[model samples]
Target: MSDEVHTEAHGQVAEPQEKLDPEVRARREAALKLVRKYGDPVLRSRALEIDRFDDALVDEVRRMGRLMHDAYGIGLAATQVGVMHRVLVYRTELEGSVAALVNPVLEWSSKDKESSEEGCLSLPGVSVEVERPVHVRVRALDERGQPILVEASGLEARVIQHEMDHLDGVLILDKTSRDQRKQAMRALREALEPRPAAA
Candidate 1:
């Protein structure tokens, strides 16, 4: 595959830094290509293994991290941007603390479950109530490719699991009850419809 980065919106890299350095600009421009949807075949397919954290891969990870932040999304997966790699970026807080996970694995989950509203960029405006573990522990590579284990409970844990599911080609719709899926789909359709021009 080509090493080119994909982007949705044109121009400027989505860097958290104030100045758009060359690297940052490149990453920002590349990320636009990643803002695709669940219907895309890539989203449904399995992700690729992350062997080593090299330059290009590192750049992509950073770009993805910044893009997720720029998009105001709490979490994002590599598949969300057309890469079939098991990588994800997320922020649990708006104050800029972030988490970048590569080849993440959910090591353990709580028996307890909770219902929460979940949505995805690929799924667009469709949001659904889904049941998920209240606590989860995951092992993943940090941005530098170092192994890191994270144990989270409550909302933070829920967000991690939700994004991790995207890595495995699982959407909330797939887990939701059929009736709920149908309702969410209807709402999505309505939201997507083009509005009539003003009279």
Candidate 2:
């Protein structure tokens, strides 16, 4: 899944409804609709390794990049879009360009850890504090199936680990403290609850 909450750290905030450009808002809404929400079985299933790196795989990566941009997310996994392929797209920064990783393997992670608040696109409105490695090394294939290695630290590392977890059917709630998990569950329940019909 992707995290859009960090956008605020870059001096960006959700615009008021009236101030939002209609086309932009529409695109964002449409992109979000493609993402599988929390409780969808696909989000809990491990993604399958992708062996074929064809034009279709390239197209999928492009589509995921567009969706991630439109949804204001830094990263997105195939599972979040109901695709069980072990693929993910991400940008190191909120305003940066996107990159794709296929069949990624976590080669190493530093022992140092740091806790940060993270939000997920699938679990909208829910934020949990998660502790993760401060540095990591990952090996994967590019969208075109070329070998690529990534060494990341801090927020970038966290984002990669978060997306990797999605590939393994794990969520931030599973990595967070019990109290935070309970709070997140409560928030999720409230969001899923149907509101009364408008008069």
Off by over 4 Å in 2: 7-19
Model 1 Cα lDDT, one tens digit per residue, 41-120 = 88778788788778988898887877776554667788888888888887665445767888889999999998766666
Pick by TM-score: which candidate is best? 2
lDDT, candidate 2, at 81: 97
Give a tens-digit lDDT track for model 2, residues 99-162. 8999999999999998877888888778877888899999999989899999999878888899
User: How far does residue 19 in candidate 2 sit from its true spot (Å)?
Assistant: 5.1
Least accurate stretch of 10 residues (summed lDDT) in model 1?
Answer: 1-10
**Model 1 segments more than 4 A misplaced:** 1-34, 192-199
Q: What global local distance difference test value does model 1 have?
A: 0.70
TM-score of 2: 0.92
For this target, which candidate reaches the highest lDDT against the unseen true structure? 2
